[model samples]
Target: MGIRMIHHICIQTEKYTESLDFYTRILGFEVVSETANFHNREYNTWLKIGDFMIELQTPKAGDKFNVWSSLNGGPVHMGFLVDSVEEEYERIVELGYKDFKVKNGKIVYEVEGESLFKIKAPEGTEIEIRDTDIK
Candidate 1:
């Protein structure tokens, strides 16, 4: 089967509200839908960024799970397209998120003619930002 594109990514959070705020305020995502599963005792909120969607969920009581640990080494990194890598890097620093720096103005990945900058999320998830179009 030929895949088209990624539909959405689900992330589990300890606190739903806190994660919602971080994605909405810091990462610039807009809420598209929200619901609470009463039968399962879980909560979920969906946010949209460009053509992608991020689904945030909170586990039910007595659920044995840790979101951060599960995300380690998974294919779940989200990349944001930006105009300037330096500007976005500076903004992330000013916002107080611990970030990995690129030494000597190095770019993370080169695709086509674009420059990439990778940043880590509050939960140590790597996010790649492309300053140019990927061709």
Candidate 2:
């Protein structure tokens, strides 16, 4: 088998609506698809950011959980490529999301990247924005 770029990333959120808004409004992602699994009693929402997609899932009551926790420092977070890291950094700051900082002279929106500021999303998930070709 050959390796390829990431097709998508799945994140579990107790606050589905808040996560959705954070991705769509704050991070400038759009919803591509959504489905509800009756048998599993879960909801999945797919969000598109550039060429990559993120799957937000909500587990049913009493279901065995396997996603990020709201309390335990959250998930590993996700990275997003931007045309200009500085531009995105300023935009994120104006949007009023908390926990914004710069590191290594690069604008980081999350702790996942080695450079710049880290931006924390509403669901406690961080979104790291970097200057790279995401296409």
Candidate 3:
């Protein structure tokens, strides 16, 4: 029950190259570190945006072994803070990201009872975007 703080957020994607580019180029996060996964013979990289860190990992290939990420309870989904939720929503759609909606049970944004909206990245990852509210 000692869930005090989040150390890092991990994302597992088969399209590691695409995901990395989306985070670094599209979202403008910087690569702080990277290393090789000796066990799986893949690449592991870390990107930073402000105070948050994201770990991008690739799944093992040619495998018949039971290897899994520690984040197995759920797949990768990330949230991004924007200056304007509506504006970002439009921009994301214009950039070809689809499935954008705001009807769900999730973090409540401090904008007159409106919660956050959701969208999908290129590799089918859920990305939630909300206005720039600390809460």
lDDT of 3 at 4: 72
**What overall lDDT, based on C-alpha atoms, would model 2 receive against the true structure?**
0.71
TM-score of 2: 0.70
Per-prediction count of colliding residue pairs? 0, 12, 0
Q: Which of the predicted structures, 2 or 3, would earn the higher TM-score when compared with the native?
A: 2
- Please, what is the TM-score per model? 0.69, 0.70, 0.66
Colliding residue pairs in candidate 3? none
Runs off by more than 4 Å, candidate 1: 37-39, 67-73, 99-115
- The candidate with the higher lDDT, 2 or 3, is 2
**Residues 9-75, model 3: lDDT tens digits:** 8766777788887788667789998788745848788899887888887767664333343366775
Model 3 Cα shift for residue 47 (angstroms)? 0.8
True-vs-predicted CA distance for residue 6, candidate 1, Å: 1.8
List CA RMSD, all candidates: 3.9, 5.0, 5.5
